[model samples]
Target chain A: DARVTQTPRHKVTEMGQEVTMRCQPILGHNTVFWYRQTMMQGLELLAYFRNRAPLDDSGMPKDRFSAEMPDATLATLKIQPSEPRDSAVYFCASGSPRTGLMNTEAFFGQGTRLTVV
Target chain B: EDKVVQSPLSLVVHEGDTVTLNCSYEVTNFRSLLWYKQEKKAPTFLFMLTSSGIEKKSGRLSSILDKKELFSILNITATQTGDSAVYLCAVEGGGGSNYKLTFGKGTLLTVNP
Candidate 1:
């Protein structure tokens, strides 16, 4: 069975550190999405790429947070000078145009938990 | 602003009971509404609804979307301890621009045996 894979399932970093999370989308999926979940903010879309090109990153903090799809199979989300408030579970999801109802059913990775102190 | 809201926030039910979870959204360029079952970690895909009055089903879980009312419902029949999890609802919007999903605060379901 194909599934989205993520590395470094858990990480602990001090404030102002640089942290990077990686994801390997299921083979043949053309769209990848990055989402952040917190108690106060719920699930928020940080960025996404379609066909290996960024379609949107407005929700991402331009200064510290960046998301990129280096290749069809690999996507990355990075944080520079990370803050304690940035602590949350980051999820990577992959989808194909042929997916359920209007291509909305996305396959999610077992999220990476980041704790910034 | 586009948003999705889920009701009850949390629920407790006994095994063999039935439960219904709700999701309401106000989104422009709505494309579809999807349901996901999240246990301790990864969220598994459930149902996706795009049109009004059509019910989608898988085993004892079923879902229906009401585009006119801007809401959807997920029904789980004969709940079991294994059914305990967070149920997330997300809306797919910006169909022409790019597929962006706005998710709600999931409903945490607890099924007791």
Candidate 2:
């Protein structure tokens, strides 16, 4: 079965360290999204890309967080000088837009559990 | 900005009991509402509702959306221990958001045998 793959299932980093998380979406999917899950805030949308173009990154931390999809197969979220508050489970999801009768369902990656100390 | 809210942040029930989880959203040009079950891994797809009053069913789980009321309900019949998980509610919106999903704080369901 086709699935979204993510590298470094777990990471523990000290404060001020740069952290990078990677995702490989399912073949043929064009839409990619980045989400963060935490106990206090639940799930938050950080950024997303459609067709390799950045659509919106309003949810992301403008200064420290960046999300990019250099190519269709690879999507990355990076944090420059990460902080303790950045600790959370980051998820990358992908979906092919389905208009009309078809439904749009996002397939999620296993998620990278990041703990910034 | 699109928003989603789920009720009963946590619930506890005995096996074989029925439960209903609630979700409400305020999104412009709503495209669909989706349900996902999350355990120790990533959230898994459950149901996607795009229309009002249309019930979507899968095994012991069923869900329906009410666009007019801006809410949806997920019903799990005869719940089992395996049904324990965080049920997430998300809304897909239109306009600037092509298919971006805004998620809510999931409802943690614990079914004890």
Candidate 3:
């Protein structure tokens, strides 16, 4: 079965450190999304890319957070000078429009659990 | 702002019993409602409802949406211990080519044997 693969399932970093999370979306998917999950805020959309192009990153903190898809197979989310509040699980999902369907269902990876001290 | 709300933030029920979870949303140019089950890690897709009055089912888990009321319900019958997890409700809103999903806090369900 095809699945989205995420690296470094867990991470622990001190405040002010830079953290990078990587995701490998399903081979043929065209849309990629990055999300952050916290106990207080639930799930928040940080950014998304369609056809390897950045579509939206409004929910992300432009000062410290950055998301990119350099190529179709790899998508990355990076936080520079990460803060304690940045501790949360970051997930990556991919989807492609199905033939004759208006919307496509997204497939999520296992997620990277980041803990910033 | 677009938002999704789930009721009964936490719940506990005995195995074999049935439980219902509620989700309500207020969004502009609504598109679809989706349900997911989150356990120890990432959430898994459960159901997606776009039309009202149509029910979607998979074994003991089923869901229905009401476009008029802007709400949806998820039902689990003959619950098992494995049913314990956080149920998340998300709504897709119309926008540009990039469609974004807004998710609620999710409802935590615990099934006791």
Candidate 4:
């Protein structure tokens, strides 16, 4: 079946290390998004891309977090010098191009649970 | 700021019982409200409500939206163990931006046999 796919379903790292997570959006879809879910923050959008280009990333911390879609099928979110507070399940979602006021429904990946010591 | 809130953070019910999940939101340039069922892996799309007061149904699962009150409700009749999962509510905005969804904390449902 068609679905978004994420890599390294689980990850553990020490503080001050770098972490990278990858996502493969559904074939033919153009938009990709990265979100972090936690008990206190619920779900927060870190970044989104439209047609392999970065659209908005205001929710991401410039110092340590970065997201990119180097190609149409692949999107990646990376954290440099990760901190203990960065522990949470990171999800990658994909949507189609905007159609009128509504866009294609977003499909989520299995998500990668990260734990930083 | 856009925000979505889901009530009754959790619910417990037995088989054949009915339950209702509520979600309220405040968002600018409202587009649509969507419901998702998250089990073990990813969240799966359940329903998307746009028009107010129109009940959308699928088998035993149904949902309705209230645009005036900025809220929605999901109703599941005859709860089964398979229905035990976290239900999520999200709101999509119509602004020019690519489209950001404001999601609620989700309501966890537990069904006993």
Q: Write one digit per residue (lDDT tens) for candidate 4, span A53-91.
A: 887898999999999888898999999989999999999
Candidate 3's residue-wise lDDT over B1-113, tens digit each?
78899998999999999999999999888878999999998899999888999999999999999999999999999999999999999988757676767889999999999
| Alpha carbon deviation, residue A75, candidate 4 (Å) | 0.7
Each prediction's DockQ against the real complex:
0.79, 0.76, 0.76, 0.64
Name the regions of candidate 1 deviating beyond 4 angstroms. A99-101
First chain TM-score for all predictions: 0.95, 0.95, 0.98, 0.95
Q: What does candidate 4's lDDT look like per residue over B16-113, in tens digits?
A: 99999999999988888999999887889999888999999999999999999899999999999999999999998746865677789999999999
The model with the greatest DockQ is 1
Higher-ranked by DockQ: 1 or 2:
1
Residue B102 CA displacement from its true place in model 4, Å: 1.3
As a whole number from 0 to 100, the lDDT of residue A29 in candidate 1 is 83
In candidate 2, stretches whose alpha carbon ends up further than 4 angstroms from where it belongs are A99-103
Q: Please identify which of the two predictions, 2 or 4, would achieve the higher DockQ against the true structure.
A: 2
Q: Least lDDT summed over 10 consecutive residues: which range in candidate 3 chain B? A: B92-101
Report fnat in order of the candidates.
0.81, 0.75, 0.72, 0.56
* Docking level for model 3: medium
- For model 2, report DockQ: 0.76
What are the Cα lDDT values of the candidates? 0.91, 0.93, 0.92, 0.91
Error of 2 at A77 (Å): 0.5
Once model 2 is optimally superposed onto the true structure by TM-score, how far is the C-alpha of residue B40 displaced, in angstroms? 1.0
Clashing pairs in 1: none
Error of 1 at B66 (Å): 0.7
